[model samples]
Target: MTAHVQQLHRVNNLCAGLEWVADCPNRLARKALLQLIGEEVGFVLEGVICASEQKIPGGRPPA
Candidate 1:
């Protein structure tokens, strides 16, 4: 999220946004924000985000 959106309809939207940040392409700012989301990632996404540090490829996690 480069810029903030003002109108979020539901609380779940925030949660969904976190999932998007987790699974979507790499963004240093987003990753930084993701760390503040708490420790439920392993239980919630089943390692979808926690399994590795890369999402797109050809970067750090490729090794």
Candidate 2:
């Protein structure tokens, strides 16, 4: 699989893990984990966006 697909899968797994951690008894740790997950997902999305933006309108990406 491509790196983009792998990153998406990783983000999906992180989301699922976040859902499981939502029930944790420790509020601080839970919040920290959630924040980390959010940041990770954000970084992945940013990368995707940057990659897309790198493509030009000539039916090909810049060299």
Clash number for every model?
0, 0
Cα shift from native, residue 7, model 1 (Å): 11
Model 2: which residue pairs collide? none
User: Model 1: which residue pairs collide?
Assistant: none
- lDDT, candidate 1, 1-63, per-residue tens: 111122222234556778777775668867776775434433444333333435446535532
Give the poorly placed runs of model 1, Cα more than 4 Å off.
1-9, 33-63
lDDT agreement with native, every candidate? 0.49, 0.79
Per-prediction TM-score, please? 0.29, 0.78
Root-mean-square deviation per candidate: 14.8, 3.7
- Whole-model lDDT for model 1 versus the true structure? 0.49
lDDT string, candidate 2, 1-63, tens digits? 287778888888988998788998999999998898899999997776566657645444533
